[model samples]
Target: MKWYGASQRRGTLSRLAPDGKDVKAVTLYTHTFFLIEDGRSDEQKQPHYTAVGATPEEAEAMAFAVYQRAMDCNHAMQQKGPMLIECSHCGIQRRVLLPPAPPVAVTRKAERRFFNLF
Candidate 1:
C-alpha cells in the first residue's frame, strides 16, 4: 500500500527496478485463527486472531506471539497494544492496519430493485 508518498510492502519501501519501475510486494493479507488455551482440552473459549502483518503469514506469527506472551500467566483474557514491526528491506515499520469500522447508513429502501437481490 501507499505510505508516506512511497509504495511499501511488509515494511519494505518500494525501490526503482532496473527498468525504472517501482517494485511492489504482494498485497497485504490477513487470516482468522482461533486461539485456544496454550494447552489442551476443557476450554470452551476460542479467540480469533486480531492482528495484521505485512503478509498473512507474518500476521499470524506476530499475533500468535503476542497472544502467547501476554497470556503466559494462564489468564483467560488479556489485552495487547498495537504491534509494531520493522521491515528488513527498507526500515519502514508500522502497526498493522486496524479493522475497518462499520459503514454508516446513508439511505434505506430508496428503490427496491428486483435484480438487487441477486
Candidate 2:
C-alpha cells in the first residue's frame, strides 16, 4: 500500500496485490489550509492574518496578500517571525524562517609603496 498524489489537487491511496493488481484504492480530497500566526507578540489572542488555500502556491499567495495588507495597515512595520505549515492528512508540520542577512564587506587601507631612486 502506498499513498501518492494524483495529477489533480487530490491524492490517491492505492494498494497492490501479489499479481501486481490494484486491490484497493481511495482518493483523498484536498482541503483548504488555514495557516495563521501572531506576529511578534505571542500573547495576542488573535492572529495577525489568516492565510487560506488548497495548494502550497495558493497558500503562499494568500500569505503574501496578507503581508501587503499588514504593511499598508501598519506603515510597513509588520513583525517578522517563524511561520508554520501543517499537513492536514498526517498532522505533519514544518516551520519557515527568514534567512540571515549577507555579511558586510570590510575595506582596508592600501599601503603606500616607496619609490626611492636616488
Clash-forming residue pairs, model 2: none
Tens-digit lDDT string for candidate 1 (1-118) = 1112121123322334343465544445553333344553322233333456566678657655544554343433322435444333322223344568899888776776798783
Model 1 ranges with Cα > 4 A deviation: 1-26, 37-45, 76-118
lDDT per residue as tens, model 2, 14-109 = 344454554544332232222233333222222233344545556556555544444334222233335544333333233455678799999999
Instruction: Pick out the ten consecutive residues of candidate 1 with the lowest summed lDDT.
Output: 1-10
lDDT of each: 0.42, 0.38
- TM for candidate 1 is 0.29
Structural similarity to truth (TM-score) of each candidate? 0.29, 0.26
Model 2 lDDT, full chain set:
0.38
CA shift of 28, model 1, Å: 2.6
